[model samples]
Target: MQTYNAPLRDMRFVLHELHGLDALTSLPYFADLNAETVDLVLEEASRIATEVLLPLNASGDAEGCIVENGVVRTPKGFREAYDVFRDGGWNALAGDPDYGGQGLPESVNKLVEEMICAANLSFGLYPGLTHGAVMALSAYGSSELKDLYLPKMIDGIWSGAMCLTESQCGTDLGLLRTRAVPQEDGSYLLTGSKIFISAGEHDLTENIIHLVLARLPDAPPGIKGISLFLAPKFLPKPDGSVGPRNGILCTGLEHKMGLKASATCQISFDDAQAWLVGAPHKGMQSMFVMMNEERLGVGIQGLGVASAAYQSAVSYAKDRLQGRSLSGTKRPDLAADPIIVHPDVRRMLMTMRTTAEGCRAVGIWVAQAVDLSKHANTEGERKEAADFVALMTPVVKALFTDLGFEAASLGVQVYGGHGYIREHGVEQYVRDARIAMLYEGTNGIQALDLVGRKMPAHMGRYLRRLFHPISNFIEAHRKHEAVAGMVEQLERAFGALQLATGQIAQAGLKDPEEAGAAATDYLRLLGLVAMGYMFVRSAVIASERLAGNTDEPEFYRAKLASARFFIDRTLPQATALFLAIKSGKASMMALEEAAF
Candidate 1:
């Protein structure tokens, strides 16, 4: 079995080189964070990931989680690991300082998340969901709610869950049947069932706070009538101690395809005592705060697992002896050369490497944009940052996961029969990454949102956020001799994305179905362009670093190589996707309802 190791060097390269640390440090809130401080934080986080979490991954997978007598019990060693995690202040890495948090920049914490996911994704879910829950509560929860729940949840004495999907509803929250009846004491009685709730029940925390979406008794039908509520598993007493158990119960634990150790529960709330987080009938507005961040978190999850699988594949290729190289006998003393020497094997390796690295850059860049959106000094800077984030969030969520699953499957392919076997662990990456695309509004829904909502948002303001950066970068570097070929390739791909975006937007106005038909491919096309842009940015940085005779020449050289692979191979797919987006909805909508 290949044990997980945090790719600290690559993480540093992405953070400090491609997306500068100064971006975060420039903010007044992040004034204390410099390269050295960030490096120390990452190093310590890497230590925990490699040492504490990695050792328990396979064990947890094998043991899974057990639900008995209404309480969920996580796999062996999970409780202890989480204790260490919480005590290490890992839970509050990017939390608010007012509530006993570290108050770090989100971009810094994003790398920590990637490391956790790569090391042990099942274990990471507990804190991952908690972080989202805290975001919602901090943004919209009443002062009382925040004073009571935020401190414990942020400190990890209590965990949290987002309860939105019910039995009859997934993406369509309008059809939900959950009801929150108003109480005489100013709270509500939440009576509903939320299905597929991650981290819904666990023994790792003293209490569990649930951010549920439900409807008021007097509410009109559909989404507008829906409201958000904060319900706890154990109600707190007047002294702030754990009191009586609330009405919420983990009725059952889901038998999943992957992340077996992460408890996904079917929660039943029979008149659960709850408090409203925001204004009545404004639940969706509050929930979007969590949803958007969770979307980015899901993308990071995909990147993490794919990175693990890629590392596993690379490690195996270097060690596994196979037939002689097609070119010649590279290892003359041995009967067979390693599979890595084969051209075909190298191609697969390059695909995994380029995709994983390119996606990392893209994900981190978005993370930086998120920090700026929240903390930038001026309104112009903040809105510009927000626009970029809105445009790329769907692309990151959909494309990163789509490519992640592909990369995981490629790992299985690279390992051949050994990959399918459980002990090797590459297959687990595939299984775990499979669900990211389905949850968090599904990749299909994300594509629809990108085409229908985000592109047309503020009369094309969001789309322009993406377009301007690439256009500016291209114009500035068009004459640079070192990267001329790469720039030319990126320019063509950027044009493809522009054409696809315009055609989809125009087609959507005439018939919404046209946008739906083109959405998935269009999102992928947009993702490729984003990846190209990141590659170009990285290449330019690497080119400058190499010119300075940096201490790490090989590192910069490998970055340039990855960029070349992305431009030459990956960027070409944009043309095909652009053509597909322009193909119209005729073939798609031609069939009748029963034509299948």
Candidate 2:
């Protein structure tokens, strides 16, 4: 069976040692937080993950969710588990304090989110969508709406879902046909059918608040006419009690390859009453806030699954004795040696380890920027942090998920035939991990956003936020004795990234197709370089700790080893990606339309 124990030690290393807690506490918003408090929080979260959530993962997948008589029921025990989760205030860990949240920084909350996702991704979806809704309402909703919905949502009494996709429209909102008519009392009556809505209808909460996108009666055609509306499963009375049911129903539940415990619903809205969120025709702007946050959350989901898969793979590797090691029979007392002793097995294990750890580090780095973007004292500092967050969003979303799926697949390979069957539970990781690459603005779209929009935004101001820091880091550490080799690799990769950036900028301006063709490769190149940067920095920190005679020598040594593997085995992929980008859209777009 698959088992997940939160990597709390590494999380601590990332939070305290790599990205200093001091820097976070320096911000006024996180001023009250200390290392001790953070450690306690992490320990408790780990307890919940192991005790409450992890046990439900396999069973939940087996049972899935069911919808009968327009009511959706999550897997057995999920409601109780959710109550435990919500009562503990896990849902509002990083929400606004004014809305009864703990107001924790994203830096800490993201690590907690990773733990939740790792333990049970389907269960995590319940609160995950709610958190995204809370963010959107907080950012764009009017005072009355926020007052009415934010508290209950943030407190976990209610859950939320994003309603944007339709049968004909997945990526192109311009094709959406959902319509909203203004009511006399200033509310809007919405009528639409939405598909693939995760956590859209579930019995876990008292009410499900849906942020729907529809066009006003007099709205323009295409994407420009789209508007965001807040439609709840049950309307709230004046005193915040659940009122009459709205004109929304879950018509059907999607049967999927994975995340079965999460209700992916076919929702029918028949003249549902909704309030406008932001201005008319500017729905994307408000929804993007939630989408961007969810994108990051999805990236963390990838990391979470990868981490769980790696742990399960490692456990199986150490326990499953296949054949004698190539070197010799290390376990002579047994029939054969554990597979971990074999070089090929080691390769797969190391790949999974390095990918998960590297993504975790990069996630934390971006998460710190998220904190700074909101809590920084100076406007310039906040703007710089925001730019960094914006530039790294797609990278985090695409890179983490792509590599996460790779790691999960590798886990299955490590488990051999046993991995393919449901008995071992590793196959579930493969199925669950696949979806992360497709949702929250598919990785392809993420790459295009990185290349087409963000790459050229404000004459490449966003690029500066990333490139300058990495450039300075490489230059400063080029001659450092402890990590000189890794620094050298990072510098070379960064050079390739720089060249690719310039090429895309110049070539894309002349021919957009060139940029379109190179988008995916270019995004990978940048992501690899960013991860390489993190590994090099981690090595430096590990070296310092080892030199100082730290007690946790094995942990530091493992960090150094993972860093070396990333630099030696993984970072070199930058060369191939760069070559692919340099090749441009010629051979890619060369084939005739009828060739396929």
Candidate 3:
């Protein structure tokens, strides 16, 4: 059987020990928050995740969602689970205070999100998309629109969905054929079809607000002409009550490989009543606000499943009797030693454990930057924070999800043949984790964005946000005795990253294909270095704690062990990536197009 306990101890290590809550509470927006309050919030969220969501995960996947007579019904127990999630104010944890929210920091909220995703990823999609929509609307929607929609959406009375992909276009929005016509009442009529829309239509909420992208009749061709619009399943009256059904309809539901309980719909809009969001033809700009947030959330989805998978794998390793340990029959009381006694099994478990811990540290670091980006006191401080967030966004999304998939696969390996079947539930993690790499703009796109866009933006201002700190850390700790060895490893990886960045910059100027070819490997290199940096920092803290008397010595010792494993085993990948990146696009693009 699969089991997950929210890893609250590790979470506390990340929040209170590793990253420090003071970094956030010092900000005016999060001034009222303290360690005790945050702990309470996390404890409550853990209860809901373990109690309400976990039991329904496999059952939901088994039953999936159904579309009947144009109505979509979620799997059994989902509706009630969603109610428990919403009624407890989980939906409003990180929402805008002006719009009926608790106004918590993203740093805290993201940890809560990880627990929810771990317990039930499919269920997380419902409110996850809503939070993204809320962000876009809050950032770009007009005041009148905000007054009418933000409250109910934040309150979880109504859900939200993003409608960007048409059947014709997925990554390339320029190919979209969705059309919007202006009406005399300042509303637009949207007519088109969208596929792969998560939580697009579901019985969990009374209404679903869609943030859609469409082109005006006179709009210029391609992506530049695209505009975002707000369309709802049910239009609202002046009294904030549901009024009438809009033109939007659920055409079909996708038969996906995983996340079966999350409604992935094919939607049709026949002259859907909608209001414009942001300025005309600036849809991508407004929608990116939501897209970026979703990207981060999707990354968490990967971490969530990986964390759950790792826990299950560890449990199986300890209990399942396998070949005797090569060193000795450690478990002679049993017929065979527990698999965990074997070095090979230890390797897999260590890899999974290190990946989860490393990703969690990086996630929290970026999450802190997110809060600072919006609420810092000085413009300079905010700009720096925003730059850090922008640079690390792709890294977090790509690295977490990629490692997440690997961790899930390793879980299966730990379970051996039993994992391949659905009986043990590890296979479901592998299937579910596969989608995180493909969706939210796919891991490949994330790499390209990191290398092509973020690396070159504003003469590399965004790059400085990450590069400078790593550089500073290397110089500061190169000779420190406590963590000198770990710092050396980080420095080598950081050196490789620096060289790769420069090579991509200089080479791509001559041939963009060079950058494109190097993008994925370069992203991984950078991501590994970022994780190394976190691990080294963690090692420093753990070292200090262990040098003195501590209440929980094991936790700090384990932290140091994971950090060492990441540096020793994982960070070396950065060197291989650098070499691959230096090889350039010659061989990559050399093959003839018709060869296949």
lDDT of each: 0.91, 0.93, 0.93
Which parts of model 2 have CA positions greater than 4 angstroms off?
A: none
**Model 1: per-residue lDDT, tens digit, 1-596?**
64567888989999998888898898897998789988999999999999999888888888999999889999999999999999999999999999999988888898999999989999999999999999999999989999989889999999999999998999989999999999999999998898999999999999999999999988988889989999999989998889999999999999999999999999999999999999999999999989998999999998888888888899999888999988889998888898999888888888888888988999999999999998999999999999999999999999989988998999988999999999998888889989998988999999999988998999999988889989999999998878988999999999999998889878888999999999999999989999999999899998999999799999999999999988988899999999988999899888899978
User: Against the correct fold, how does model 1 do in TM-score?
Assistant: 0.99
RMSD of 3: 0.8
lDDT of 2 by residue, 130-214 (tens): 9999999999999999999999999999999999999999989889999999988999999989999999999999999999999
Candidate 3 lDDT score at position 297? 94
Worst 10 residues of 1 by lDDT: 1-10
lDDT winner between 1 and 2, please give it. Answer: 2
Off by over 4 Å in 1: none
Candidates' RMSD to native: 1.0, 0.8, 0.8
What's the CA error at residue 293 for candidate 3, in Å?
0.3
Q: What is residue 317's positional error in candidate 3, in angstroms?
A: 0.2
lDDT of 3 by residue, 1-596 (tens): 78899999999989999888898888888889999999999999999999999999999999999999778999999999999999999999999999999999998999999999999999999999999999999999999999999999999999999999987799999999999999999999999999999999999988999999999999999989999999999999889999899999998999999999999999999999999999999999999999999999988988898899999999999999988889888977899998999988989999999888888999999999999999989999999999998998988888899999999999999999999999789899988999999888989999999988999999999999888988998899888888999998898898899999999999999999899999999988988898899899999999999999989899999989999999999899999999999999989888899996
